[model samples]
Target chain A: MSEELKALDVAVEVDARGTACPGPLLEAKRAIADCPDGGVMCILSSDEGTIIDVQRWSKKMKHEYLGDYEDDGYWRVFMKKTA
Target chain B: MSEEKPNLEEMIKQLTARVDELEENAPGDNLSLGVISGDLDYTIATFIIALGAAAYDMQVDLFFTFWAIASLRDPKKKVKKDFLGKMFGAMLPASSKKLPLSKMQMMGMGPPMIRSVMKMHKAKSLEELMKEAAEFGVRIHVCTMSMDVMGIKKEELIDYPHMDFVGVGSFVDMFQNSKQCWFM
Candidate 1:
């Protein structure tokens, strides 16, 4: 999964590190508005809730949640704006 | 003989109609929030949940009553009021920024400490969350009866984009139509 995401073309990358709960998710929602449909978006977050929050947000918005990868102290959550 | 025996097609038709009715009666993608506390922590939590739900594509309504109404007061706006109204205004928190924390309030030290922590974590402040909530189309309803009891005038409230002065009955109607109800 990490290898797949690494090769995927991400149109937008939101850096939400050091933000608290729901902050990263909110950032992703705002950034995804500019991302074209079917474009992959990446969110870098250090919050612990980002992993599940992104997945749930993606599902609710009818987007495709590509999953997350841990790097150093932060995480990279990926999603496709299919909706 | 036909009158005595139940027809399969007719039974299926009846069941389908019943299912349709059930589906129509189910609650929709809406959330009703009862905000009764004026404490900074509770107020923040209320907006966080409301904003999150709004982002999830849910129609969100926040009904502010009693103490929570103080959080909506505009600090910069001054209005003519009776003695009682002035007293109430002086007693309650001036605005969201002036609200106290619910616990560990050591002579008003807790709020600032928590605020700094929030800033350090890059969490949106209460004002920012409220603005974002309005931007997300979250409806804010202030309780008419509570406002009357507290001697708060509509002009004294913040100029939120989607705010309205409403009665408890209106909130009840909203609550009944919502898929979920939260009391904070």
Candidate 2:
């Protein structure tokens, strides 16, 4: 299952590290949609509110909130449209 | 001095139709777009919508004249929502934070409360969105006369790479040669 998933996905890199909450999330949505469906969106934000905003917004928007990762100074959240 | 200027009539027409799309319904379908004149919440929404349109590949040229230029401040800094009721805590689902619509206008109390509620719910800030638009080639033009009239200096705005300082004549000429135009 993991192998099939990996084979049918695309990833977007959104560098919104210095921005405030909504900015990063919105950009992330944009970058994610620019790719094909079944693709993964990685939103990188440094704002204190990024995690919460993405978590809530993605779920509401119907995108699957995969998880969050920390690298260097930013937080990246991944989402994939499941429906 | 004016003699040294090249023929604008010919040059301006060439910039028509193809350089920038002018219609919102049809992305990348307008070379002449609307010029929004003020700085207010609705104005900000207009900017956001324009950016959204451009993100869809539309060519948009926004002229921020008068108070509209004031919105370029640090978006995360302050302000609350308008008549819209506010939301609280990040974990709270946005649906749970729906604005309570009022029927009999609650006097002037609505504005402040809206702001408080928005601050509480945490509406998305506009800074990063503006920056993203600039990166995607959405041209933001600031009016020089309005800046001077409002006592604002050029050095104050954020570092948006595509921002330009142009006058009304430029916008007029550009729009005159365009197929579609609007004023928000």
Candidate 3:
């Protein structure tokens, strides 16, 4: 999963490292909007809830969920805006 | 002759009709909130729930009555009022920004401390959540009777685009149509 994620060029980066549940997810939603269609967005979050929340939100919003990776006590989630 | 039993086709038709009838009577995908408390924590909790529900595509109706109406006031907008009204308004916080904690306020230190903690955690403030809720199309309804009794003018409240000054009956109608309702 990391290999596949590392290959995709990230069009936008949202640093939500200190944000808690729903905050990271909401920030990702707003950040994804700024990216062009089919563009990739990377979000960094310290909150554990963000991993599942972003996956669920991506599925519900019909976006492409590219998985996540943990580094330096935070998770970095990648998503592609399909719509 | 033996009495005839209903055939498979006839049973299927009856079942389909019953299903249609039930679907017609089902409540709408809406969450109705009765906001009765003006306490800071309670108000924050209310907006959090509303925002969460709205995020999931649920229509949210917030009915503000009595003290809860004070949470909608605009801190910068001052309106002339009678002696009792002025006293009541003065005692209450100007807006969601000035609301004090329900317990251990410590002479107004508690609110600022809590706000700093929220900031440290990167949680959205109550004011920001309220704005997001409005942007998400949550309908904010102010109680007409409460405004009359408290002598609060409509102009004193924040100018929310979708806000409606309504009566108890209107709120009841919305509640009846909601899939879930809460009184906070």
Candidate 4:
């Protein structure tokens, strides 16, 4: 947990690994709400589709996409809630 | 004699006016779904589409009629009914969770097998998709006439927020206003 926090500088971490497709994306959306304005949220997902989905969702929702990193069989995506 | 060049200012003004008029008269971007199948695959498909559209920022209206209304029933709720109605209710799956696949049911083993496979593949289950759809503000509507004909009471359905019990006319109005409509 500390490693992830250090790696992403995220205020909130959503563990959506093992969830499929829209599940991870939905979790990211929900987690972003808990983040303060301009605060970063990190989503950990194993689903391959989430990479593009989160990116698209971030763009559509006007969030700042901080990019993603692959770690230990999962992808960690970072986004800052702009709205 | 050479013809005079078209007036750029006048053409721009006319085009802008036409754009404004189209925007004013554009129908609401809504997706209306006529869900008429109670099979597990169909129910899952309905919710998947609804959730996908809702996530994409499109307003979604799902009208559950005929056999499809069975997918919204609460398994724990038991409604008293006449003998025939009781038999009918008993024959149908109690809730979305109990819905069987349209094909290869294999005496009810297929659904559980498929669900396990979905889980293994990290796919969202029907129940999970339904919850997501609700969170995304998808409007779920139950056909009142179908409920009455099937001897199902309001209490027998899951109490989703903003769920509506309406007649065919209400569904028609929604269909007419929707930019895209599907009967599945």
- The prediction achieving the highest lDDT against the true structure is 1
lDDT of 4 by residue, B30-103 (tens): 89999998888988888898988887888899988889888898999887889877887888778988988889
List the global CA lDDT of all models.
0.85, 0.55, 0.82, 0.79
Per-residue C-alpha lDDT of model 3 across residues A1-83, encoded as one tens digit per residue: 88888788999999988755446767886788799899999999875446655665676568888988987888888988998
Q: Rank the candidates by TM-score, best first.
A: 1, 3, 4, 2
**Model 2 residue A50 lDDT?**
62
lDDT of 1 by residue, B1-184 (tens): 7774578778988999999877856678999999998899999999999999998999999989899999999989999999999999999999999999889778999999999999999999999999999899999988765786788988989989998765554566678679899898
Interface RMSD for model 4 amounts to 15.4
Report the poorest 10 consecutive residues by lDDT, candidate 4 chain B.
B1-10
**Model 1, span A42-78: residue lDDT tens:** 9998754467557756765689999889989888989
- Give every collision pair in model 1: none
Q: Candidate 3: misplaced stretches above 4 Å? A: A1-83, B1-21
**Taking chain A of candidate 4, what TM-score results?**
0.87
TM-score of chain B of 2: 0.54
Interface RMSD of predicted model 2: 16.1
TM-scores of all predicted structures: 0.64, 0.40, 0.61, 0.60
Q: For each candidate, how many residue pairs have backbone atoms clashing (under 3 Å)?
A: 0, 12, 0, 0
lDDT of 2 by residue, B1-184 (tens): 6764566756777677545444422333434444443323445455577677676676767766654666553333333432321222121112112212233225635434664665687854344456667777877777655654454445555567777665554455446444556666
